[model samples]
Target: MSTTPLPLSALAAPIERGTAAYRRANFALFLAGCSTFSLLYCVQPLLPEFARDFGLAPAVSSLALSLTTAALALAIFIAGALSQQVSRRRLMFASMALAAACNLLAAIAPDWTSLLLARTIEGAMLGGVPAVAMAYLAEEMDPRHLSGAMGLYVAGTAFGGMMGRVGMGVLVEIGSWRSAMAAIGAFGLIAAIGFAALLPPSRRFAPRRGFVARHHLDAWRAHLAHPGLLRLFAIGFVLTSVFVALFNYVGFRLAGAPYDLGPAGISLIFLAYVFGMFSSPFGGRLADRFGGRAPLIGGIAIMTAGAVVTLAAWLPLIVLGICLITIGFFVAHSVASAWVGRLARADKGHASSLYLLFYYFGSSVTGVIGGWAWQHGGWSGEVALTASLALAGIVLAIRIEDPRQPDRSDA
Candidate 1:
């Protein structure tokens, strides 16, 4: 932890304005991001199997997935704040490695309760990566390349998320659910080692002298003072809650009514996430060209429309709706996340963690509530819940006026 402050030019110089090393580093971090998210979400497709094997209801079985995300949301703030004391590279590497081990433990668990405990631990360990990765890029990457690098990292996350959902589904079809989980965990372990090998030593990170409650409070105060930051935080909560709720209950709906899809078929629905990979990068560039506000608002609108389309019983329309939803989610997420880096004056790590804490908190809370909707109101109920959340997001986006013009800091 270097106590001395270095010039901004020196800290941000490692990734030159436009250089190959910068590009390579960005790509490496993208892969690292993918691996981290894939490991975190791999259990999504296995929810039904857990219910059958454990003799639980839809909401109870969902606890397996929801608990991990809940733990992750809580731990992210701790991890980000702690990074001020520890080395970023060492913390990220350890987080991935330990999370992988926890997944392995989950694969071998004898009962549902044991598996849930393992996943909770894994989620806590996994929090270190996302909470700190954005800050690392902000500190090291050139300002011009920041959005691109962030977009690439997000692309990796989209891909990893798709792979985790689709891969688990495919693997479970051929083998037991435990085998699928173990395989995904092994892949994560390998990716973790690769990430450790490829990520260059941090050249820009400087450790704070010590953690103080005042510093944390000041960071929060600074963030809350910024209108854009508050809007982004609200959007994070609403967008993620809506997205998670849709995905969480889609399988249940598809498995029950007209579709009667099996676990493998249900897993295939995650294929829609492939659209997110492209949309994320495209959204970033669009934001770079046309300001972040328009695309951010437009993306949410598109997602809202998609949620409406999903109400149809026609499978094709539902698939198209999912694709639109996926595209909208990644675009909004990429812009909003990159925006957080721009808005925070200091302690970017803490800001990023706060953003993700709201993001995952939405997933954990709304995801379980979605099950109740699915049970009672059927697909219509699910649609109503998600659409309402998306509508709230749109209203929030509308409220976020352009901050380009000078305004009082304390509004």
Candidate 2:
């Protein structure tokens, strides 16, 4: 019941894993992850509907998600740097409020252009959350508890991803995609309030107020120059690209031909994210019990095998394959992200931002490229592309060494 604090030189102590304070911190972050992902991804299942309503190609329809992620990728770098000058909690709160408001604007936008503009701005606002969340956890959580805490946050993402996709699908069937967006925006508003209320003050982080760009640049350069961190960043990129590409186009594949699944049916596929939710924490525990190296390799191998299984035409096999892919991706992501936090001895915010910058970049580029592949070579082509990327991830992950020491509690 009592919190344990571990000292780290000049820095304040970290919140340990199994305590009331730690539980509350994790709960608040869980809601933050839930709101963030739910708002960002609610439109995924509606891509086919966007195509029908907007009179667009499959590749263009994917712009709905790709554009948002693209903007998010760019904005995170600036937000990460800004966290050094501003209160990190305030930055995240403002981001959640602004993004939820933009989602409302997007829900009511009368035209496709207007909708895209709203979503783009929303993506920029969302940039404040993900990178900052990782950095915050790394700074405030005890190193012994860091992996599981990160896993819990990632699980929240899985829950949100599943809810957002599945919720929109069901809502669209009941009403329209517009109504679905409105509902998700309303949910985000409530979530933001809960996050603001429940999250505790930062114990380990102190705001550094200055307009020095050189300090920020130097931090980024340090992370980039680290061989292990560089490889992890590459792995993040490939992993996300492969995952996003699959989900972006899989709707088109199942909606036509033998599967002929409707919007609600396609939504069912996102239930695979439940498997992801479980795998994240499970993978974190495995890494803690064993080591990051074997779990990382195993996850990538599972992803590769899952991609191959999905090549089959059978619907049952396809669903099973999707489950495998979902579990594998989340496990790998949870491990890789935790490693990034541990590897960075300083400027963890910058390190987290760099990792996510590449991650979302993969989502932006590969999502669109996968669409093109779907347009030309169909599902088979997309599969080949993603499988190759997953393979590349395996090789990159293999090159990363386990950390020589546990994370230090310093900013």
For every model shown, the clashing-pair count is 0, 0
Which residue pairs in candidate 1 collide? Answer: none
lDDT of 1 by residue, 115-168 (tens): 999999998998889978888876776554566667778899998998988887
Residue lDDT tens for model 2, 140-204: 88876777788888998899888888878778889999989999998888888888887777887
- What local distance difference test score does each model get? 0.81, 0.85
Give candidate 1's root-mean-square deviation (CA, Å). Answer: 4.2
**TM-score of each prediction:** 0.90, 0.91
Q: Judged by lDDT against the true structure, how good is candidate 1? A: 0.81
Query: What's the true lDDT of residue 244 in model 2?
Result: 84
Off by over 4 Å in 1: 1-10, 14-18, 52-60, 110-113, 372-377, 401-411
Candidate 1, poorest ten consecutive residues by summed lDDT? 402-411
Best lDDT goes to which candidate? Answer: 2
